[model samples]
Target: MPKGEGKVLAQNRKASHDYIILDTIEAGMVLTGTEIKSVRKAKINLKDGYASIRNGEVFLQNVHISPFEQGNIFNHDPLRTRKLLLHKKQIKYLIEETKTTGVTLVPLRVYLKNGVAKVLIGLAKGKKSYDKRDALKQKDMKREIDRAMKER
Candidate 1:
């Protein structure tokens, strides 16, 4: 199966608008019991999530996994940083690629594959304001074309 073929729990819609994705990789997440439960219920947010490599490991930051409703004191923190599991070779490649200016690792989507949570991270470069405008214009034009074709 493809990297993000399973049921998606949360998607970072703004990530694509703000950055141009160059490549993507799938990595497993280390989640606590409660956190996994919340994720399974689709109570997760990836709006401000980003990945950073630290000491040769990658950590996901700013992603919010809401506390499980039925959980008591054992519920995990909603914004706790989580570790991402990736191969050493993949990590090395990410390190080299991210060393370039303006390049970053952003979590694009989170999904469950084979009952395990996986994150699809993208290697992206920031998009300028004008680039965003151009993309919007292109989308509008495509929409108009599709509308015209549909009416014919």
Candidate 2:
């Protein structure tokens, strides 16, 4: 983070390497007290997780939110499907766009924004192996240029 910038609670590193994120949408998570407590510790994983729109609402699937250690029996499920809160219009748009061929709704990151937990969902399209290699090439080229400039 830049100096004085807001602290980042968590990030999904796999999302950047695997998916081609075309657009981002912020959605609120419906979390219980125990779940929120685990999030505060940054004990969360958005890797291998996905979001889907169903019946005009969104739900996150397969995300691992480590159970709150102190709560016995009442601890939130580690892999429960959590509902996402989004505006009606935004939900509608996401549903429509994701329904198109080769596109999916991928959860990018989960973080606290201004005291509220928000998920940065991405409108993504899967990349083939060649496409991934091409992306890596571009990134490597840019890094090389930066290194060259720094040593000058």
Candidate 3:
């Protein structure tokens, strides 16, 4: 299917408001058994999650996958860092892109695709306070226009 097509389990709504997403990449996640179970249950928190490239590899940090209820002793840590699977070329590009100031890698959403867990990571640039206000104004205008059109 198309990129990011799947049942979205969790989304970081604040990420969109805090940063301007320039591009997105879908990457598979390496999860333990219990971790996958938790993900399937939609017990995941993408807030405070970010991707970092280290030692030529990408890792997802601060994403909380709640421990499975029935996993008992087999439950994995809720906030453990998870490895992200991306091609070598993609990693290289990300490494280069993130080197720029104010640019960051933020997890936009988590979804299940074909029974596998994937994370949609966005290349984002931080929004200034004025930029945020402008965005809000634009959204309000768009909403007003849509409402007027719908009532016509």
Tens-place lDDT per residue, model 2, 1-152, is 22332446677887777878899888889999999989888899988999988888899998999999997888988999999999999998998898889898888877777777788889998888898899899999999999999999
Q: How many residue pairs in model 1 have overlapping backbones?
A: 0
lDDT of 1: 0.95
TM-score of each: 0.97, 0.92, 0.96
Reference-based lDDT, residue 1, model 3: 33
Q: Residue by residue across 17-88, what tens digits does model 3's lDDT show?
A: 999999899999999999999999999999899999999999999999999999999989899999999999
lDDT of 2: 0.86
Q: Which ranges in model 2 have alpha carbons more than 4 Å from their true place?
A: 1-6
lDDT of 1 by residue, 47-118 (tens): 988999999999999999999999999999999999999999999999999999999999998899988999
Q: Please identify model 3 stretches exceeding 4 Å from their true place.
A: 1-4
Q: In angstroms, how far off is 98's CA in candidate 2?
A: 1.2
Give the TM-score comparing model 1 with the true structure, all chains together.
0.97
Q: Give the TM-score of candidate 2.
A: 0.92
lDDT winner? 1
